[model samples]
Target: MRNRKLFILLCLLIAVLVIAGCSKTKQTVTQPAETPPAEQTTPPKTDTSTPGSGELKVHFIDVGQADCIFIQLPNAQNLLIDAGNNDDGQAVVDYLSQSGVSQIDYLVGTHPHEDHIGGMDTVFNTFNTGKVYLPKATNNTRTFEDVLKAIKARGLTVTPAKAGVQLVASEGLSAVMLAPNAASYEDLNNYSAVVKVSFGQVSFLFTGDAEEKSEMEMLAGSGAATLKADVLKVGHHGSHTSTSPAFLRAVSPQYAVISAGAGNDYGHPHREILQRLSGIKVYRTDLDGTVVFTTNGQAVNVETR
Candidate 1:
């Protein structure tokens, strides 16, 4: 009887030891398997917080010899300022399609100049324009006529854009029209629809061919307002008449984008202006192709195509 009891006790001890060993092995195998999934999940969380990754974007298309600026609001709203020259109409259309832009929320023609308003005809015919802003001026050019006809055909109204007017572009973007006041100047460049767009901690100034005359007025009017910007679209393709030293000093942009043709006849992006913009990062579409400015309301990054 004593031997039988001892045998039963030994058997019980062996069973407990086997079960404990199995439990330890299972924990060791399962722990390593569970750890990798946790590590894998951490990367995506880090990626989302990266700067410029989740921010709004602005694309300055290289429509040689003219200007076409596409602003993508944080909410995905679209704003187009001038569509290059007539030759760029089809290219602009193709670009918008590729970028998934089916409609334009706000379309602004800086002036009646062909290079500024010509490609707009194609844009108007192709997409739905919510509001149309144009300089309060007229030109009898066929290109301007075509743009007008398209706007009328679409039943869109032409509104004059002026300073002090503010509108919401997206959740974070605010648009302020800053040119074409009642006080007239002899030059059409003075009438160009200048715009100052602001978002959290960042601001951009778009001078649509506005020359020294308009820049002076803007600076004088905004005395002490501090129009410093993160980005500046070089006025009049960096022409000598635009981007005056005083104006550049007032705005003090961090980066400047020059939209000019390769070997343009007008001598765009004059060397003097380039020199005056010393210490500022410059991107020229003629050399770098399309320039894309992207920001997450904190910092802006430039990418060339």
Candidate 2:
């Protein structure tokens, strides 16, 4: 009887243990898993600057008595400021081709004057131009009309080269228009667009034939103090009519570039303007052939032909 009672107790204990194990197993199988938290992140800023990578290079092409500064962006793209005179259009195209410029990201006709927009039509027809910027002023010259016709032919339109407009050149690089602040001007030179091209810490001021009237307005504008740059493309080709002392003082550039023809009639880089630019390093297109400044954003290396 004692053996039978012991056997029965053992069987009952074994049944209870098995039931408890099954209940625990079922509970564990039915339990829901805990979810993980979502991660936080911010989208990076968009760099809309046209294709470019590597060092930035600015080439002040030797166009006699005219202006045509070709900027090679860090992204390997090109931006032409002006294309010299009408006769120099083919030269600009050939130069670009030799420099491996397959396309022009930006083309700027600072003013409607022939000296600025003369070769613009040829450039527009020769290479694919991305965007063109022109000031509000009009000269009604054949050169200006040619540019307009070319733009229309390319199914493109000109964007007003006004203050505050920005040119996205590349990542960490850009340019902003800083002049032609007024609505009207009697002199076409005063209507020239002044653009400040900056990459990293280095900056360049390209004043397209802007005279005292424009300079005064620029000084009176909001970005007056921001005109400071490492390089200044002297206005009116370093003529007595422009590059006023006040303008020079404000810009305080380390180097000044004057674009003029050798033995030109206007006597560009006039004695008075040269006197004003005494302390600043001056490079004339007539003397330097083609002046090139290459920058790795912070510092620059200048080379001239």
Candidate 3:
């Protein structure tokens, strides 16, 4: 009987050992609970523009003596300064479409002249327009009528092109109208809306066929300071009638761009105007074809096709 009790006690000790071994094995194999991931706070947006792309492209379309400036702002917004002649409407449309332009954030008709606004109607018809800007001066020609009709068709209103008209183009870019300060001018060209565009450390000035009268008025006041720009689109397609010495000195541009047709009877981009821009880097549509300048807010990269 004592032997049997010893066996039973030994069995009980073995069972306890097994229990302890099993508990240790479980503790060794068991893993701690994992923490879940944090929730996102930022809402989703449709902007595909690269935050640090650091480039703004400007396309100077060769419309054969007509003016057309297409700007791709840093914020991915597009701006069309002026359209070419009437026959060049389709060409401008094609160029914009090729450039993958889906919308026009700003449509500016610098003046009521046919060369500046003739193709605007086609642009209005081709792309989704955000806003329209035009000088108060009106013309009785069909080109002007077409633009007005196109704007009406799109159910958009025209904003007066006057001084101090500010535009927030992008996060670091803005444009302001610096001309058409006069309520009325004897010549329509005097009503041209000169725009000054700034981005970071760089700036551009677009003067639309403004002559001495308009320029003098600009110079008489804040024009000296306001006209200064890194680049200047030489006024009146380098016509001798415009781009006076005083205006050039006031602008002090590093680069000058002239859009004029080759072998034109008007003798646009006269030799006298070219001489004035001797110190500035001149890019002409007749010579450079489609001239482009890409800026990284500091340096301008020139590309011509």
- Between 1 and 3, whose TM-score is larger? 3
Model 2 clash tally, residue pairs: 5
Off by over 4 Å in 1: 1-54, 169-171, 224-226
For model 2, residues 1-305, the per-residue Cα lDDT tens digits are 99999999999999999999999888876663322222112222244443556678999999999999999978676788999999999998999999888889898888888888888899999899998999888877788888899999999888998777788756678888888898788999888888898888898999999998888888889444788899999999989999887888999999999999999999998999999999988999998899999998899889998
Q: What overall lDDT goes with each candidate model?
A: 0.86, 0.87, 0.88
Instruction: Assess candidate 3 and give its TM-score to the true structure.
Output: 0.85
What is the lDDT for 182 in model 2?
A: 84
Model 1, backbone clash pairs (residues 3+ apart or across chains), number: 0
**Best of the two (2, 3) by TM-score:** 3
Superposed Cα deviation of residue 238, candidate 2 (Å): 0.5
Listed in order, each prediction's TM-score against the native is 0.81, 0.82, 0.85
Query: Top model by TM-score, which number?
Result: 3
Error of 3 at 70 (Å): 0.3
In terms of lDDT, the poorest run of 10 residues in model 3 is 33-42
Question: Per-residue CA lDDT of candidate 1, range 96-157, in tens?
Answer: 98988988998989888888888999999899889899877877789988998999999999
Q: Which consecutive 10 residues in model 2 have the weakest lDDT in total?
A: 34-43
